[model samples]
Target chain A: MGSITLRAVSKTFGSTTVLRDINLVIQEGEFVVVVGPSGCGKSTLLRIVAGLERATSGHTLLDDRPIDNMPPYHRNIGMVFQNYALYPHMTVYDNLAFGMSAHKVPKKEIQTRIGQVAELLELQTLLRAKPSTLSGGQRQRVAVGRALVRQPHAFLMDEPLSNLDALLRERMRVELRRLHERLRIPTLYVTHDQTEAMTLADKLAVMRAGEVLQVGTPKTVYQQPATVFVAKFLGSPPMNLVRVESRTRGAMNPVGGAEEAVAMPAWIQEGWEDATDENGTIWCGFRPESVMKRRGPGGLEIPITVEAVETLGPRCHVHGSWGGQPITLTAEDGAMWTRGAVMRVAVPWDQVHWFHGRTERRIEPRPARLETLETGGAG
Target chain B: MSNRLSRLVPATAETPVRSAKPSHPEKHWRLPTDWREMLIGYGLILPSFWVFLVFYYGPAFFLFYIAFFHWNIFASQSQFVGLHNFAILFHQPVFWLSLFNTAYYVVLVVPVTTLLALALALLLRESAGLRGGGVTRALVFLPHVTPVVATSIIWVWIFNPNFGLANALLRVLHLPALNWLASTHWALPSVMIYTVWHSVGLYTVLFLAGLATIPRHVLEAAQMDGARGWLAFRRILWPLMGPITFFVVILVSINTMQTFSQIYTLTGGPHGGAGGPAFATTTDSLLIYQTAFLYLHFSLASAMSVVLFGLILALTLVQKLIADRFVFYR
Candidate 1:
């Protein structure tokens, strides 16, 4: 029922900066997840919001009220730590009631709230069980229930599912999504797992090297990554990035010469001259799933020399080199691919994302082209 | 062979894998190797066993044996006494005084030392990773490591009625200084103070170790839940520290009950020599020592030693019983 905003937030420990100039907002009833690899300061950003850590240079606001200097307990924020951090000596019921008791909630209300949470989390039978006796998934529910019973302004979860086994994590992920749908509490979740972020977040922020690179819907961040890092970070078998050696107006030469030069769509070519002005370095990226085995009109064809194939039940990843630059493309698992075999895959021009080499920032297709691109462009 | 195969497979398996034996080479080698391993373990323990038997159990059993006999160090033949030592001990007002004094010392030292150690531990835990923390910890523990006898002698001089640190501090605070070790009322209390100061360090460090085993996130979680300071400590920290507190209490109790050298060194000065002007500071352990070495009443001393042993064992077992109901392992 409250919004959390971080304005120009930065954190430094001695000389090394762990977070820098970060700006993010979690709207009322929205689920915002900050996702990145470990040591990227994603957790630090979440800690700043929870008031566990103070921002060095910026303010955190809960409902636009400055909360940077507020003690964590005074902030009335409920955070589920990565390890659950359940009071080992307390039973599930006591753990759920602890915060309410701390806040001096009435005894009757505490009982009612705990009963509701326990039932909601399917933890009725586990009310008397201590955390040590609970399984990982059960403990996670108790942790979530502890936060839920507080009825805080917002919720913060730090990789809460990371400790659970894969099957349990998936189940809990779905459960968490369903719970969010039902309650609509503003939540700021931080995780290193991309799949979890993509599935759970209403809005996603991708961070790298102490800075947020992109903040948008998961689909938009995946489709229109702001930087080369984002393009490479968000997907499984990530986007294949090939360096552009040179380009002349409408035609661009990719570094690998095994294939002929690819024809640049007019929209892409419009920004090439202005975007690649620095050191004239450019990167051509296309998602692995974007590569079709059959050619489409205006699609660039590249022959991939297959070196290894990984069969993943329904689909397979074909890892290979194109002109000495490594590329991975997915194919139906039934397809046979031997080592050193050459296969041709076509990537439609619209699927190609261009990036400037020096800045590594994505070169957006012009506004005029964006509409046509969204509607499935004609060659 | 079937039993072995069944042990390897699930109980409800439709078909047991008959190929289990060849897959596990350890099954064939386990018996002889286990024998050899046990032999190595016993070999490693043999030297300590020899020392304990010669220096500990042998004397203990000899003490029990001679408790029934009035043995003299100078005489070859000694008279047998059946329950005579116990009869005399129960009637002796000095023996009752020593027991009462020992009880008083344990009561004073155990709880006070525990609370002080816990407070110091909490302070140290807060200051951990701060500058001078290591130096503070080492300074606190320094007294425990110093020879008890040496420190006790220094303490004797410090308790001097006219010109000592104890009286000097009293005077600085504008309070009158009284006879410390020399006074019957003040003698035991002074020794208790010294005992706590000397031993609180070790218990504090024990507490620090217990606190270290707790996860940092648990406390942070408590903070987020609006539990801070005293509430967090009472609900989270104290509950978690149950086992160690139990251990420290038992250790301090046993140690306080058996206290000897400090009393011998501190109180053994001009006025009455050792057990005070009128046996004011005489504890059970000191009484046993005096009876055996000073008065040469070995049988009577052995009887007292048995009582002390019985007291310590009974106290430890009672503590264990109480702790089992309260302590949480995780």
Candidate 2:
């Protein structure tokens, strides 16, 4: 019954617009993660949905009822803040019981609910301790317990796990996922960490500069990013994007001084053939993992001089220059290469992403050519 | 063969032996390590420490010693009269009356001033950066910095029964004019009003500082938890401000107890005999001054001083004990 729909939501602070035309929907039991760089308005979006902030335009509906005009408390949404925000003066038991007491739940029912939540969150033994006495992870569990005890229609979390150490963050991530599955409340979690977005989200919304660049399943966004921004933002060391000028119809020359020409894959050329620009320029993007050492190449081969190598146990990132543009390629540890060594790297034609130079919008490859490219390449 | 013979000799026997008596090296007299630095540190604070000891503690100890004796400024010698001054003070109705008046003044001033300051702080905190905020704060704080004697003189004029601003305003509202500082019934109240106006601004600034320390996210979280406005203040803001409230209570209590300048300026000087109109406004401090300087009962005044000091100390300790039960340090 907890479904949230946002329509044409925008927020402006004075003259500066913090969010624009934000349209999204979360089905019952869905977990949506909104992610962006710092100051991309992800936190503001959560606040607006929580009714802590007012949107300049548009409506937010929870369970098919308009809640934009409602106060934060009346909106029936629970929020876990980035800092936990537990009342320092109150014991953990009281912290969890505060909202229930304020809403005038029966005293007997409050006790029962608190007992159940404490058992569920494994916080029974620490119920009398103040928040100052609890460990960071323990405090986090208490914060989640506080939110869960209310049994709100939905939950809004603003970087709840960002305060933990890396190992604890990973463990909490799994626990949160399990908690979501068990409770099935529609939750909107916001974080700057892409790993959290990818792992915890049933649907991921990537935002940049006050607008959602793309929203899709993590797998879809990862494999087929809709924009150069999304492609560059979602991956570690990021995807390698090269600027090129389209020469004639099927070939492209690097925009810089390098004299190398790369033949556009038949599928990419076919996708853009009908909508060819007069200047014939485009931006090409591919993930670091997609580029491999040339192995009896039929795919496009680009020669690169290695500038640096970062060995990360099982895999190493090879930082080098390709056609005067800096590119990073992730290779297995067995692909050992030293600095200043020239190596030929092959990009699977099907894996290459094409975007218009000016607008940076994805151009869908022709279906038949894409199928051939996928089958012809080794998986 | 020679090398083998040399190796066969015992090592200890070949070594040189010292005399049975051990020699003691000359002990040089030197300061301990870091002594110079400690000296320098003490040297830096010695002036202020000396002033406090000489001016404050010196008089306090003298007063305590003289309270047990019949001491007079004109007499050549003081006679030791153990507990005689205290015994006389206990039997006097004027002493009890002054003590009660002082307690009344404290009761009126502390809570009213603290609450008013907290309310003003809450209202002004949100508008701190707006157009009129700085000007308003400065105006409110002006009386605190102004000379008490000067402001009390202005208040005397304002409290004038005939043409003063207070009476004029009352007349505009169609109320009868009444005596302020001149009447026995209104004297203490008039002094309390002036003291509150002069002291509230300082507490207001203190409360504002305390309010700023409360993290914004905590309040937002409270609002999200279905606690708004008064509920949020009661549950979150008030509890979080416990330490500051305790501090403000102690400070205002002490300040009100020791108030002298306003009383002196408002009720006329010692020639007019401090607590005028049948001692209606006589607080402990004013009574102590009038008894010793005006009536030449120095020993009795010293005894009253000791009692007043004890009362202030007991009150502060009791407040601290109570605060420990409720105020959250963190």
Candidate 3:
């Protein structure tokens, strides 16, 4: 019943367009994380839904009813701000009961609801303590409790865990996920931390420069990013994108070095023969994990000069240059590689993603293969 | 290895070659050697301290001393009169009337000025985001910076019963023209109105500063909680402003009690002495000034001064206690 739909929502402050043509739907019990860099208008989009901001264009709906002109209170949406925004003057119980009293709920009902929420949030011991007396995590729990006690239609969290320390932030993320699972309310959470977005979101929307670049399940977005930005933004070490130009009909060379040119894997040539741009060039992207240590038969291989290695307990990152392009690969057995060692690294052909060099959009694998390329395979 | 270890250890077997003990390493509570530094620090403040001692504390002590003697400024010799000034003040109708007038003025001015200033501050705070807010603030604050005597004279002219702006407005409204400063019933109120006009600006600025210290997100959170307009003010803003309200009340109380310049200018000339038209505007300050300067009753004036000082101190203490009970400090 708490479904929220935003259609072509745009916001312009003076002449600068902060949010442009944002369209998203959050279903009941769905957790959508809007992940973006700072100033990406993610917060503005959330505010528009919460009615704290008015969209320059388009409509926002709550449960099939238009709420564009509705005030925040009338819309019955609970929001958790970045700083927690707890009333410093009020105790934890008062903070939790504030919203219900504002809505003129009955005294007995408010008491029962506060008791229930406090018990659920483990805030029974802190009911009489003011916000200043609570620690960061405890204050954050009280803020969430305040929103929960309201029993609003939906929740909008604006980087609710950003102020917490790293360890507490991790713990709170799990608690937030558990809370959402228990409550089953449609939630739109905004954050710049990719790990939080990937882990917490049922659906992830990657935003950049005031535009939603891609929205999909975390697995889909991680495995098949629609654009180079999404691929670069989502991963920790990020995707390694190397510019490659077709040398002949079937051979391609990583840019800046001709000695590294090799025959394009037969599967790729067969899969995207017609998908190459007019210049026969494309930007190739692959995850660090896709860079295999051992060369597989029929796979594309590149010799990498290892520069440095970072050992992270069980796994490590091998940093090096492949065909003069900087690349990092996660290696499970990184102890075998040493500085300045030249090793043959193979690229699994199926895991490689190709983008048109000019448009920067993913190129679909086509079934067609050029007959001239088969004839000119000798080159 | 045992022989080497024995050599490395300075054996206590050598009968402990003891060094001479230093003489008296500790002295009990020696004076600070940096006495020159202390002298310089005290030297820096000595001038102001001397002024305070001679002018403030000295006069306060003298006021107490001379209150017990029948003294006049022009008298060659003063007579010792124990409790005589107090006895005369107790029986003096004019002194009682002056005390009542002062209380009346304080009761009228403190609340009116504080509330007016707070209201103005709220209005100005709402417009603070607008372009003309600074100019409006400066305009309101202009009267505060103006000389009190000058503004009070202007107020006297405005309160003139004949051909005055106030009576002119009343006449335009078809109401009978009433005497303002000249009428006994209206004289104290007229002075109070002038005092509020002169002083509301400063307190408004104070309240504005207080309002600014309230975080924006807290108020926004209140609005999100469905508290708007008067509800927001009553529940959130008022409680948050408790400390500033207390401060303004104390300041206005002290300022109103010491109000002599305005009453002197408004009613001193051609009205009736300093008390004016049958002692209507005679506050403690004005009465003290009249008793000493006009009537040459120095001992009685000193007694009144001591009483006023005690009253101010007691009232201030009371206000502080009340403030401590209610004001929430973050």
Q: What are the clash counts of all predictions, listed in order?
A: 1, 0, 0
Each prediction's DockQ against the real complex: 0.69, 0.57, 0.37
CAPRI category for model 2 = medium
Worst 10 residues of 3 chain B by lDDT: B12-21
- Over A1-379, each residue of candidate 3 has an lDDT whose tens digit, in order, gives 3999999999999899998998899999999999999999999999898888899999999998999999876887888888888877788888888878888999999999999999888999999998999999999999888878889899889999999999999999999999998999999999999999999999999998888888889998998787878889989799999888876667787786656577676655664544556676678888898988888875668788899999999999999987788889999987899999999888877788877677676654544224424564210
- lDDT: which is higher, 1 or 2? 1
Per-model TM-score of chain B = 0.87, 0.88, 0.86
Docking class of 3: acceptable
The digit string of per-residue lDDT tens for model 2 on B189-264 reads 9999999999999999999999999988888888888998788889999999998988999999999998888898
Candidate 3 local lDDT, B1-330, one digit each (tens)? 242234336773222321343346475344453664466568869999999999999988989989999886777888899998989998999888888999999998999999999999999998987999999999999899999888888887899998789899999999998899889999999999899999999999999999999877677666667667786787678888998999999999999999999889898753546567888898999989888877788899999998899999999999999989888777
TM-score of each: 0.91, 0.89, 0.87
Off by over 4 Å in 1: A247-250, A256-259, A266-280, A308-313, A333-341, A368-379, B1-31, B269-272
The residue-by-residue lDDT of candidate 2 on A123-164, one tens digit each, is 999999999999999999999999889999999999999999
Select the stronger candidate by DockQ from 1 and 2. Answer: 1
Estimate candidate 3's RMSD in Å. 9.2
lDDT of 3 at B115: 98
Model 3 has a DockQ score of 0.37
